[model samples]
Target chain A: MTEPPFRRVVVIGAGLMGTSVALALRRFGVEVLLEDADPGNLRVAVSLGAGVPVTPGDAPRAEQADLVVVGVPPAALGTVIADALARFPSAVVTDLGSVKAAALADTRAHAPAGAGLDRYVGGHPMAGSEQSGPLAARADLFDGRAWAVTPHADSRPDAVAAVERLARTCGALPVQLSPGEHDEAVALVSHLPQVASTVVAGLLTTAAEGHLVLAGQGLRDVTRIAGGDPDLWTQILSANAEPVARLLHEAADNLHRVAHTLEKRDAAEAGLADLRNSLERGATGVRRLPGKHGAQPEAFSAVPVLLPDQPGELARLFADVGAAGVNIEDVRIDHSPNTPAGLVELWVHQDTVPALLEALAHHGWDVHG
Target chain B: MTEPPFRRVVVIGAGLMGTSVALALRRFGVEVLLEDADPGNLRVAVSLGAGVPVTPGDAPRAEQADLVVVGVPPAALGTVIADALARFPSAVVTDLGSVKAAALADTRAHAPAGAGLDRYVGGHPMAGSEQSGPLAARADLFDGRAWAVTPHADSRPDAVAAVERLARTCGALPVQLSPGEHDEAVALVSHLPQVASTVVAGLLTTAAEGHLVLAGQGLRDVTRIAGGDPDLWTQILSANAEPVARLLHEAADNLHRVAHTLEKRDAAEAGLADLRNSLERGATGVRRLPGKHGAQPEAFSAVPVLLPDQPGELARLFADVGAAGVNIEDVRIDHSPNTPAGLVELWVHQDTVPALLEALAHHGWDVHG
Candidate 1:
């Protein structure tokens, strides 16, 4: 069947998401109008071809607009959406905020008494980088990513459908989720992860910072998320404090158990086992994520092969695995620092592990048990 | 200056390290003789060009071996080193165990009940992956990496020099450290990292395991070290429990504080600033890691740029940056799970950030504020 339609679209904010929505909509043959209070942002959007910039001076043109996408900051979101609704009463409205519950509550607060309310559909495109501003916007920015929509009780079926169509046009799969459920999920996946990474990174500055000089890939991986932008993350964590606080509290309780185990016992086996089990469960939770570009199915196995640490050993192993007619879903190598002569670990697909072992062993490779 | 002669090198315990040392020594035109309890391992070593594997049946050309390298498990290190000394008189011996402090202490227990113990030097190569067995042996595993030699007060200067020369011949830099100091440093840099990763991975597996599906790059990073061989790590953590425990306790304390700060805080500017500062410090700490290939100079500059999530965006960005004559030292990207959009943080020379920023800005890119 032919595509439905991508008609006149208005993206308020002209910041990262707004500009992205406008640029993405352009690919679908929709005429996009990007608006922002910041003059520089509007100019940047125009330069990036997100759309010709729009302002209150040209607000009259939205009379024929079919869709309105909100991408303003969480605090200022209500006023912007209300203004958009007041100007274009018939346009279907949705938001692209991280916190859906608070945004919905704010949107509810701004609706006029029984007027221009049915056109509003509370929505959040669960997408964005820490870096913001109009210049950071990109076409196809949400391709194959999730867009969670949480409609209000009073929202019309037509409004929700129109918003769904808009989301589809922007290359995101529309997933219906309750605002509260969405917040809790992100608290675990997004919010808790950022905070955990920060604390781990902080540990490097302890009694002897000199040891951090030898910080290897494992430490780097554990603390990678800690390098995000602080100002915007401040806004996000603040907005979702209630749920994030609950998640962190849960993590702290578990961490306390770990600390007591390590300090009181010698082996700390029981405590460490509990922690290990929990982390395995966490890893299981995360493995359910769709692969990049939404192209592959869920992956679970971690195949490991012993390797010698030589200049071309890694490259050879990968090439060896590739020649085995098996695709490596992903790979991770372990670099242990306590050997007189270095060894390496190659993690691949579990099914591929047997074949990889056979192929490499035939090549005179020294794979271990 | 001509190096002091280390002619007949004896490698005790013909396992992975022993076999690899045999191979490496052969490359240097040194006559090598290896010994292992397992006859099969010695055969494998002989087949792998690790020199003629000598067993107890044929007492190793004892007095001929100028340097005897002990390659045994940490659990048996003391006994192994002492046995080699008792069997071969006048051999400058060194053990290649993970923890030098514990190994030195254990060897001290079985030391010849007399003076002139200056022939033994404690050594460990700060390289290798988490895999054990003779099949994991490599010829050039220590190339370009640092080897820490922890010599006790009783060790002879000539013995230390000989080991340093051996490390150099193996293409490694020799860093001298006391046994206790080396153990503590490794606990922080190596052992603590693995434990932190395992603990973090445990956090992902609570409740019904749908969260595992979402284990994107962030969680992968946090838990990467978890998949390591738990048994080998157990021996290591047990040997260095004091420092690893200390570091983990410090991390747990900080995590608890961060969790507390996120609890039921008011929406005031002051409260927001505290959270922002905490995250900012995390960013700074992560940035303090050593650069690629162990660049002794740590500090590097980064330029943040936004790119469209399309095939050509990466190529376009690289072309633009390269066309400006700027050399990129490294690149780090923020992987956003919910969106195709990501932030690209490029590390370049300190002086190149401004020029790259100017070029990118001139080309209408949005660098995050």
Candidate 2:
């Protein structure tokens, strides 16, 4: 096995992010020590082979470790980083905090005079699920994901390199940004959407039962993120309050204008124009999003294939497509409740659509254009 | 072959919905006559076997048909239904208008004294795609979907039955509602979500490039409907303006409160509480949505299987799962952009999870919990 970049690493929190980091490092043949305020969490992480838990009688792992990762919640980030810095005088320290600006500020305010501020780098991995805790942790959690690293001007080049190496070793692509820039970016791409989904979905709580029966894919797609953990989101939002508030205020203004224009009979034409502009702008924005394989969004043709609602049917369909040598770009299954059949929409490159349709049809599959 | 309920069906407006309706009816051996202001659309529908086009010299098919279906836009519904009713004096007339109240009123005002208001039933099928036009029409578009029917008290029983029969014949479940109630219901469940998605997604047009790189499934799901045609959505929203405006105003207020609390440093505790309540309410609302098979959401354990991004890997995996005798409840593929591997998350019944895991592992597939 190759020599790991960090000989010994210490993880300060044994939660999902922390445990996953430890597990990833362990997969790279590095020794990892797990520490958590809650003994139960520490035990779980240790049992899962994330790392060896630091016992009370053990030597101070922080002082001996080459690197320490602070993976606690935003509220506790400052104190944890401060304690880790004071304890590990020679080790490089980094944090996996969602909001970097506040954590960096708090760490700067609390760091001891002799403690190396330059040794600290801030990281926010753009990966997570609705689930939490060590049980939800996986070694490959960060595989192929974007890990944003925010370095201060005074930060040591060696410290930044260490963090980047860690990210790369875990198969994550590191993108560098300043703390404020990181906060603003996440506020737009992540925080704003979370809040919008929650607010819109909240309306459904009081919706008439009959109205909900009419709900379709549009509502389902719009509100899927509303199922995120409320407590965790509250902490995240609070840490990034300024940027989030600014965006929310702007959204509110737009919404108010739409409602006002729509309510006025004389403004019908204006209302139509405003609504159309918003939608068109949305179309342009969504189109810019990176498609599969990190390429620009390409226009793909959808060939809908009818499949029996049975185990292995999807496998059979995929096998036939593979036999035809067609690369399926994306797939969406639209299954009606109480139906024995589903329409699996296979999105393929435009050039390959004709061949795919012919191949599937020859294989006795019902392919709908 | 079984005789279709309607011997001859006249479909006006040969667009996506109209063409799909004709196609579905044609599947049951009904003779469908297609009419559209755009001859290009009419020709395309004819080529797709959606229906036969009515030639200029031919006697108007509407006058001889047993049913006259007006599948026009909200703005054109009034004129088309009026003309169809006048031409087909002995046939039942119904319209597939997204908004029923305004169209019903318009038709009522335009109908001649001898024309029967009782023959008209307003309809809006709760099924569609982002793609429109005759080329996007599918025979099974309405299979197992809801078709909302709005009828006035003056509507004749035979007329209501005719509409219901048409919906059933097209493989849609007919749901009866008043014109006013239908508008209110769609405003909450459909129109409001569509507008919210557009406004939220519109913000991305001004977002920095680096920010969009971090966009995830949440942003994708929340903004999917924002890709809809602006002209079509404008008409849908305007026709249901009253209820949509009411809902938008309420959403704006909620957004303002959350922003205010988040902005005030002194209100951190209160802000967290408010945010949590909003998220919790959203959770409650989303929970009430019908799950697969139109039933309450079932708790399914996700079994993440690591698959190589090769042509036949999915098929092979499915074949293995089939051999294991496990029924996959649902599946979501979370593939990282540009990665050569993907994690296909297979949702299965809790009881079958262990068996599925064992079988997959035994079959040499990488299974992750």
Candidate 3:
């Protein structure tokens, strides 16, 4: 077996991201030393086989590690990165904070002189779940995900390569981008969506009970992210405030314009045209989202099957698909709040739709176009 | 079996809603006469066994029907209801339009002298798919759903009972409210979400390609409703413009406040508090949404299982779940783009979690808390 790129890695946090990285590295037979200020978090990470917990006397071992990964809250990222760099003089360091530019700026402003600045690279792995803590960590958390690596002008090329290798070992695709570019991109795609979802869902709090009874899949889908942990989201949004705030302001303007036009009595034609434009634009945006395997969005024919609300029904349906030897690209379950039956939409490549449909029907599944 | 509440039902407009109603009525052995201005739609509904098409020669038969259900576009709903009331003089009439107040007002203004105004009740079934047309109709479309029934002060009590009976026969729960109250309720629960989703998705059209590569479930969920049919949405929005516009305006004010606070660098503490409040409100709103069987939201523990991307894997998992003898309250499949494994979260009652987990583990499934 080849030597692992991050052989002696010290992870200075035992949160979900830190433990996940440790687990991924350990899977590749790398030696990982886990550290966290919280004893309980460290214990949980160690018990999960994420890594060996760093003891009080293991300072020398941590200093001698080949790489140190900082995975703390955004507010504490700079101090943690600086400390990691100062203590682990011989090791290169990287961070997995969501907001890149702010963390990089913080590290630069606070790092002690001769702290090996060139050895540090900024990384933000665009992967997470609403769930948190070491218990939620998975070795495959970063698999097939985009790990944004932001290297400064003065950074050593070897240091950047080490982080790239770390991402690769975690089964992630490394994408090179500047800190500003990274922040801007994520602000539009991630932060803005979170804010918008929260605002929309907030309105529901005042909704009448009768109103909520009329709720459908559209309302559920649009507000799913509002269930995220508020404390963590607040930290994330605060760290990337400027860009997120700007995008949200623009959205607010659009909302006001649409509302005004809708309320107008004489501008019915104009109001409709405006609403249609927004809807069409939204359609175009969703269409541009990359489909499975990072491919351009292509229309996948959905063959919806009505499945009984019984145990093993979904399994039976999948078994039928397996018997047909067709690959199921994606599947979605649409169940009404109190309904016993669900419409399972199996999304497949268009060319294979006919064969799959026939096979499913032959298996006595209630298939619908 | 006893005769259906309405033995002879005339369904106007052979679209998804109209056809689905006809199908449900027919299941109860009712004679249904389907009418649509479009010959092709009428043909499809008839071929689907939804109802017998209403021919020009069958005008007298349609007029003499026990009940007439007007299911036309919002723009044409008022005129259609009036026409149905005029033709079917003895029969009670109701409409299944999304917006009730406008349709009721239009009917009141346009119905000819001696028209059975007291027999007319307005309804809006709180069930639909993004898909439209007769081909999209399902026999159980309204089954186990809330069907809003708006009866005016002058509406006859017997007429109200007939509409309630119609809802019950179609397997929907009739929720009685004023037309104004119904419009206001839906504006908050349904219309606001649609507008917010559309606006947020519209912002993505201008996003960099790099931005979309990081898109995850949150982004997908928040934008799902943006894929709805633009034309139909325009009509729905226009019909209930006042209530929808007012609600959206309030949402816009909230957005502005959040944005302003987030953009203020000097007010970090206040900004975070504001952001947290929004998120907290969102959480409260989601908690109020009814769980399965129309019960108050109950916390269910999710047992996540890692399943291979192969076809039969889900089937095997479901089979294992069945063997556990536990009812799965809900299931969510979280698949990363291009990943060969997916995390399937099985939500069951908190009390059933331990047994379900132990059984799955015994079956060699990779179960996680």
Candidate 4:
């Protein structure tokens, strides 16, 4: 009836991910000790009921913990990890850092606990948003997403199992990769896209492209990730610079090739083919993308409607369209600074177009033929 | 009123735009003549009860017509406009072409219908989908988008008015841009981003980078526009090669700059600054995006929940959050691969976060500490 080795856990970061991990551990009836230097975050996490605070001075209670999960900022990763290992010599220690190779590079030598840092595994839950902190955390945040554990040569079998168990408890699928491999993969997926999105967003000059001041759905899509936290992504992209930079240059090369084909007044065959292939690949990539809960979702159909210039016209149109017996799938409105009227486009089920049209026509509307 | 000048309308080219135009004119009690060499599109338009077909051997209905709208492919734009002028010598003739410059250039010589060719004008509606053809035609399509007309120096006042009237009837705002200006604006806003999104999607080799394959909301946003019909976009980009190529080149330049910053290893000041400014711009851009019906949207906040991997978990969480009495303003989900258990993020009205968290915690759920 002895307590199974490592039961209680202490996660050393109270940011969004840390709070989420703490909340998740609570579901499985495990006592989670969530830590952070930020008073605001610690207070938020406590209010959320994720855990009660415990410090280094908590003594045997802290040292006797089976696992210490470090979910601190990437820049503070090494120091925080070293301190945890020293404080809890028998406990397995892990850090959730975006950069694997560098983060885990000093794991063994710095971890003064265990024969080696064998009980110290590395984990990265590839989940995020433009916002951050405990306010952004959730108990079910890690469910069904990739939780990568970049294991080092000196990492202990027990520590790896403990981390994996924690990941499973949080409903994440655990995958293993060497620190280098994980870094390279994320560089392509996460790091490169971040910089690319940023550059795209920055292209709009405050001058004539003052038009950039009024973007549409298309621009947002291409620039969504560009709006992420600068401090966080800086540490990520910088750590994995080699791969991210390589991808950026590769993207530029592709652009150059396409540009030259069109510049030379080539029949557009080569340029079209390049874009065609690229678009198709992107199409497939989008299809492969997971939906709300990580499942592939059906592509939504959008319907464009012409709205009148006067006020209340759009509301009336929507009300009329809704009465036509179809759910509005999505809507897009086009506005022109130079024009007197506006364009209102509605996205409905593909089957509802005719009904919506019939309804508007019945209402004596003057819509597009 | 001289019989309101020309009372009958002729829509040459039975495609979706042409047929939709014909249908909308009926809302105003106008006589419609739908002309098209494509019997299939004509049949669809007729089936939609849009218009009655006009035969080839008929005399110039121009004397009785106020407008003749030509909706033909860009390559054939010049030929169609000239023929419409010849056939409707006394009617104001206009065209629906995606690339205004090419169409204007092609038909520049056939201006001044004065009820003859002097009445000809070049027009383009900022609408259409991957799905094209008369079957996809709907009178509501142009209700709230822009319909640009590039008037030539020789354009008669009556002809321009007629074209502008057509735009208005379609519920579209009439935007008057010089052919060059229209071309450039679209190239920057519409064309460049389409190519970029497709390229990003194309760059994904998720099979190899398994975890990276865990594409989320960001990837979908960036790639949504890439699913456009390649053949159609090909024709569009090529027809407007000069401007599109220029924009693509500009984008390439920006990409290179970002790559260089990353390569310079100045993540702290230079690289990080670049990243942050990009994100800030993106956020600004997103905030500035027009909302439903082109209204300036209020910003909504995302309240992420760490969801369980189980199927019913999301349903349960949502029910609980809803029961907590917070109104949901909007929502989005992101999940990555290699991690079966993932984070479930929810978006809600801004300022409701604290109350919702309190409610969930009050229910004895572990959120965070």
**How many clashing residue pairs, candidate 4?**
61
Candidate 2 residue lDDT tens string, A246-358: 99999888888888878884554766787778778877777766656346346687888876544335556777899999998876644355433456688898899889988
Task: Write model 4 residue lDDT over B44-151, tens digit each, in one string.
Answer: 566455667776455555346768888887678887787777666677878888777777767755544442545777787776654567756677878777788778
- How accurate locally, in lDDT, is each candidate? 0.69, 0.82, 0.82, 0.69
Q: After superposition, how far is residue B73 of candidate 1 from its true place, in Å?
A: 5.9
TM-score of candidate 3's A chain against the true A chain? 0.81
lDDT of 1: 0.69
- State the weakest 10-residue window (summed lDDT) of model 1 chain A: A291-300
Name the 10 consecutive residues with the lowest summed lDDT in model 2 chain A.
A333-342
Q: What is the TM-score of chain A alone in each candidate?
A: 0.76, 0.80, 0.81, 0.73
How far off is residue A224 in model 2, in Å?
1.6
> What are the chain B TM-scores of all models?
0.75, 0.82, 0.81, 0.71
lDDT of 3 by residue, A114-224 (tens): 888999999988888766777577889999888999998878999999999989999998989989989999888888888788888888888875678877677877887
lDDT score, candidate 2, position B255: 86
Candidates 3 and 4, the one with greater DockQ: 3
DockQ of model 2 vs. true complex: 0.29
Q: Which candidate, 1 or 2, would have the higher lDDT against the true structure? A: 2
Clashing pairs in 3: A315-B315
Query: Which segments of candidate 2 are over 4 A away from where they belong?
Result: A1-16, A19-67, A86-91, A134-145, A168-172, A292-294, A297-369, B1-7, B23-31, B47-49, B57-66, B89-91, B168-171, B292-294, B297-369
Q: lDDT of candidate 3 vs native?
A: 0.82
